[model samples]
Target: MFRFEKYNIADWFSFYRILAVPLLLAFVWYGERTLFTWFLLVSYSTDAIDGFLARKLKIVSARGSQLDSVGDQITLIMGLIGLIVFEIAFMKANYGLILLAFIPYILQMIIAFVIYGKTTAFHTYLAKTSALLQGVFILWLLFFGPVYWLFYTMIIIGILETIEEISLIYMYPHWVKDVKGIFWALKDDRRTIRKKTVKKNGV
Candidate 1:
């Protein structure tokens, strides 16, 4: 059983997204596109809220980061399902480009899992920008129609973020969290520690 007592307020906000998945799915099942999209917006909103509260309240933890990533993945998947179901024509039209953009992300995920035994929670600035744009694009596409500019922009940022994630994976052999980006990682003490250890071990 989860120790609810130990979970802080920000953690509860993170929990809100996971707990709301079923309702979003139910809306999807019933062909309620608007309802699903609206609920998804709320879910995405909680992502920002949780992160802020975690920072302001100074209750951040490894577990919270893990939960945040899990919630994010679930929300993104649900959003994609919504887009596919509601915008089949758009998806069909851009399936090739979509796959091209998504394949790198899938590959990056595979690399992370193989190396770290879990998905990363680096929360790099690029990752945050990618997520923000993605959420906006999905919501806009669902609410209005496909905006080619936004779609293409999301694709490019997403690919760049994937490349950065892959690079970070190699930079830190062990998983680390809250990395800002490549430049920040280069200056991170963890890299120095690893190098010193490697030198001491002569390996």
Candidate 2:
């Protein structure tokens, strides 16, 4: 039942992740803090499950990767925007500081898209970890109170991570080329496995 069939059950999980964005927005917009928190938790959990299932089940495809990246960004951006609006509306925190935090965050997305034609460097482990940590940190700040030191620490780390990723694209153009090569290699490996399975089944 858990078998990986290309564009089958596994793809539904990807679609579910995408669908969570609107539900998350609704919860936050309605000021249902409890419901919003639960929604965020579930959304973050699915990020891990989707990646695990894709890799372990050998269902990783370019389309799946693209969908996953877009979904993650949408979830994160909406959450951050909601938190910022909440802070301004309720807590009356410094508008300048919030705007300061927002500028770099939006720049990261813009730069990635302009450079890589995507919202993120989806293939980079550091990029992924940076995004995951940033998401967690943002959620922590929203549900809990402001941990100023922790928030600033994550912001710094995020800036460094973005710089490192962009540098790779500029300094080593071949790095992205290498990623394409890796994808082809993975596809070839999958094809080999299918062939072996077919032979064993006497097809």
Candidate 3:
């Protein structure tokens, strides 16, 4: 996964978030709320930066998509850990909703991996929105306090995004990357094209 020879600028940006995970955890371990929140902010910023650079430079690839997804999952898990440790009261208050939203997401991962042998890179608009809301909600809670509306919005968007991903998995029947959403998936050539072979006349 850490192929220095093949990594582009955008991939490195995604890698930054992954590398920051331990630092974020260290801050959490030390009970450095301010430091943890600030470092976590950097991680979220890279999430946006990597995606923008990938699109602007036309350097997107399946590997890049997978790297970005892994970075995202790790960052989010770390962020949740930070939240649980630093904001124990808030997390306890909302544990049920958090767990409820996570179940479908976990199930989606299981189904996708079982069928596609890897994580889905759908990158659908809904997924992007969900990530955005999640980052915002988590950061807001850490920096300020709990905002019920934002929390609720993030939960709803997350569930919807996970459902869309599961649906796309069934639609493609194989791995694909950078899909915009369900509408685009319906028209994706990857889903429609069939393999063909041409034999030499001598054969």
Candidate 4:
């Protein structure tokens, strides 16, 4: 049902992330840490490239937004797997904080699904920064080892972003494709438009 009218270059880049999951998994299975790190870096890079391309080309659409969100989630999961597999000691040391950070995020996901059925694709500015930090931290750890300062910063921003996303989900009556953040969401008229579309499309 999530058909795209046409796939743009940005969509293709996102699609690459989805399609790369198996390759990434294979790397993990084979314990190819170096290869996996390089590939994960590429997958993370695509996230930035797709967003930039979509904005530059003005090819953004609900379908593209959904695709990008899916790609982002997939890449994040794969990267996390890499982190656990390769940096077991670090993850063990910081497992408590990681679990703590995930609590609100997990609840946020539940809240979104219960209210909206699917995850919100708000793509807030805070989320972008959090994602950038995640990628940087993962790559930095894999390449040069963990930096506690960066790890702590990433956790803080990530939790903050999750809170912002949850707030946006409740602020809007229906799923929104994009939002700047809580501040802009305050005055975002796009909510009305998205609500109408959701009602019409039953999405």
Candidate 5:
């Protein structure tokens, strides 16, 4: 009944990862703690599976890359939201650190959209490690409750990530050249506009 081999394994894993989000939500909302934990583990495991399949099978399509990014962000966001809601409803206290860390990420997302039209690809090793750390740390907070030192660590990492993205934006000209398609697109658009202006001027 399953035809996994016919499709890219990474794509299939990414799809499953996205699908798990709603399942996780339902489990958390219904107060099924055991089930929610299992779902979280499964969802997190898919991260490794998808990365491995992409590297091993060499099927890293742009679509797969986009899907992987969406899947990751959704997973992390939902997990944090769940923690915040749980804390507020049960503990009657603020999740101040999570809220603060979110500020730079929100700014980064906005800058990415305004500057590049999409969130930049997970391009550097530091960026990837930061993401993984955030995800694992958030999940740990959810399952075990927040620890003061860990929250501080997350805040520091978030600051570093913000700096990294800002640096990337300022250095885009140097970086885009390595990504041939983005380079070509920028060059072609400039050439097209110049040609149009020259034609209009009878030059």
Candidate 6:
């Protein structure tokens, strides 16, 4: 997973977020909310940049997809930690609501791990939209405290994205990456191609 020689520019961009985790945590530990927010913004920006580079530069790969997914998960988790630490009162006030939205997400992760032994890298359209909403909400909360409308939007989109992920997990018996959405998943040849290859080899 840490094979540096195999990584491309987009992969490196994804890797940067993982590297930034400690710095983000230190900002929280030192009680530097503004600095943490700015750095977190950078992390969020990289998420967009890496995907653009991956598609534009045509550097997409299974390993790159996995790396990007890991980076996204780490950055988001750190962002949440930063929020809880710096915005304790706000988080506490909305803890139950947050957990209610998060339960399906947790279940989605469990389903992916059970099916693929790791988090998925489907990167569907809904998932991308959900990530955008999450970043917007996080930045808004950090810069302007909690906003109810943004919070509601983020939660709703998140639940939808998690449902889509769960469906994709069940749809693809083997792991896949970069599926656009359910419609695209329905037509994907990855599973059938693998089955054909296996049968061809009598495996």
Best prediction by TM-score: 1
- What is each predicted model's overall lDDT from 0 to 1? 0.92, 0.64, 0.89, 0.90, 0.66, 0.91
- Order of models, best lDDT first: 1, 6, 4, 3, 5, 2
Q: What lDDT tens digits, residue by residue, belong to model 3 across residues 109-151? A: 9998899898888889999999999999999999999889999
- Score every model by TM-score: 0.95, 0.69, 0.92, 0.91, 0.73, 0.92
**What digit string (tens of lDDT, one per residue) describes model 6 on residues 77-177?**
99899888988898898998889888888898899999899999999999999999999999998998788998998888898899889998987878989
Per-model C-alpha RMSD: 1.3, 9.6, 3.9, 3.4, 6.5, 2.1
lDDT tens digits, residues 42-161, model 2? 777777888789889987877677667776777777667667555655335545555565576677677666766765434555556666776777677667867777666766667765
What TM-score should be assigned to candidate 1?
A: 0.95
Whose lDDT is greatest here? 1
Off by over 4 Å in 5: 1-7, 89-94, 173-203
Better of 1 and 2 by TM-score: 1
Pick by lDDT: 1 or 2, better one: 1
* Ranked candidates (TM-score, high to low): 1, 6, 3, 4, 5, 2
lDDT of 1 by residue, 96-190 (tens): 88898789988988999999999999999999999999999999999999899999999999999999999999999887889999999999999
| Model 4: worst 10 consecutive residues (lDDT sum) | 1-10
Give the Å shift of residue 123 in candidate 2: 3.6
Q: What's model 3's overall lDDT?
A: 0.89
Could you tell me which residue pairs clash in candidate 1? none
TM-score of decoy 3: 0.92
> Candidate 5 residues 66-113, lDDT tens each?
677677777777666566555554324544655566788888888777
Candidates 2 and 3: which is better by lDDT?
Answer: 3
